[model samples]
Target: MNVKQWMLVVCFLCSGTKYIPNTCRTFGSGVVQPFQGSGFYVRSNCPFTLTRLTHNRVECDVSIRRGKNGLLVQVEIIINKVRTVLQNGNILVEDQSVSLPYDHTYENIFQYGIYTRLRSSLLPLTVTWHTVPAGIDTLWVRTAIFIRKS
Candidate 1:
């Protein structure tokens, strides 16, 4: 098949394929791991400090190979062992599931990215991820924190 025809075929076949959780590789301080089940849990170490003077931006990149039917992904800022999912103006809806971009067909997989800004006033906050495992399996979930200090 020609280039255009080959591309069309690829897309047609990939639409039914599952997503893949790519490994994390970025500049920041966080962890990217996998978990199972529909329960909620923490994904970071407590007592973590952010940029000293300026604001910090945290990004959560997740890829799903086979998403669960009722999967829900939520994030929280943990402080002193307190679990809080709301930060600044971030919203956590009841059906907050990992949604891949519409044009995410390059690799025949689904990917979701989340960005959140952290103010200096929220220093010493522990950023954690809580999500239900994908329908297939959890591979890699990368979380990056960017700031002048880091």
Candidate 2:
């Protein structure tokens, strides 16, 4: 093969064309009572310019099992004031579905759902949670943010 052809192959091999998230970060909030009327709480947040995060994964877990309904959790990505739901991120069980440790202490259970497209809103991107668990279960939420540069 010629030098130029070899160089082209090497470059292509070095940098694959597949779009991969360049920055991946995980953040969590302190213990919170989702069943309360507090509504949504921020789990992870980051600032972006023209380029924005394209995917997110949410994790929910609780230490106590206070009711039969289990903890119903919903994951949302809020860019500025707009909200986008990560499908399958809404979990019913606290530890089983979310796959968190089965202990009396709070833990973070991550279950990545389908990837969703997101656009920048000239503000910081935030991952929030809303729950319908009627119990007084103490919960801790975590979110993973995957970002790509435009």
Candidate 3:
């Protein structure tokens, strides 16, 4: 965690709102939830939502309200803050199967998942997003990360 992240984490905790310690950040209107990973993890600068479609399935959607100016939503799916995959135009998760959102979300997915199940437990991953205007264009991004282990 950097100084800014530490400050944000402190702010969230000081206000009586519970947030994952040392993790979670608020960039512009974007709210990113931090996860413990073994070098491969995901972090977003814009707003993203992980919706539960079923008991054991979920979907991740990222929306950049503006800066696109109705032109297009271009995104760079960065993994471990190293690898980069450029995704142009609108994000069409529907075009592909929900079983692997990352596959369609990014140009090329280098994660662990399949049509039946995701091999996430075997290799924890990390990601960070970079938009056109970056995090300097928006004021707030509403995001939520809900995980239920059963």
Candidate 4:
């Protein structure tokens, strides 16, 4: 098949494929390595701090490959124990599940709860992911945090 034909086929196959937990933007490339993860810990004074009912959005871009063994990827947010913030956001707390397809890129956003406790502040957060079936390697998992100023 020629380049244009191949592109059309891909579009047709990918069309109407609903990815769970939709976000505002998606970008990046490459397959994610199993067990490999990275995240950012924002200090309270960085730029913005979350307040009650406020929105904190996170964008995650991951790539995966179909190896000899299939696997499932799970991503979640980790809040520092010191902080008393409560997450009252979306219930679909995780990203959409994706299957390996000749090494393609996938991206999604997660909206989490803001600080609910009045006495607590300076919340530190991070993103984490793990693969099921235990042995498949993840290419890369990266996260970016955006919070509204209180």
lDDT of each: 0.28, 0.30, 0.31, 0.26
Better of 2 and 4 by TM-score: 2
Winner by lDDT? 3
What are the RMSDs of all candidates, in order? 16.0, 15.2, 15.9, 18.0
Kindly give the number of clashing pairs for every candidate. 3, 0, 13, 11
Estimate the TM-score for candidate 1. 0.20
lDDT of 4 by residue, 1-150 (tens): 799857855664566432222112111122222222443322121112111121244222222223223332222222221111112122122233323211212222232232111111222222322223442222222222333223
* Candidate 2 Cα misplacement greater than 4 A, ranges: 1-24, 27-73, 89-115, 121-150
Model 3 scores worst on lDDT over the 10 consecutive residues at: 114-123
Q: Tell me the deviation in Å of residue 63 in model 1.
A: 18
Report the candidate with higher lDDT, 1 versus 2: 2
How big is the positional error of residue 52 in model 4, measured in Å on the Cα after superposition? Answer: 28
lDDT string for model 1 (37-63, tens) is 233333332322221222244222222
Ranking by lDDT: 3, 2, 1, 4
Q: Rank the candidates by TM-score, best first.
A: 3, 1, 2, 4
Point out the higher-scoring one by TM-score: 1 or 2.
1
How do all models score by TM-score? Answer: 0.20, 0.19, 0.21, 0.17
Off by over 4 Å in 3: 20-150
Query: In candidate 1, residue 96 scores what lDDT?
Result: 40
Compared with the true structure, model 4 gives a TM-score of 0.17
Question: Residue 111, candidate 2: how far off, in angstroms?
Answer: 19
lDDT of 2: 0.30
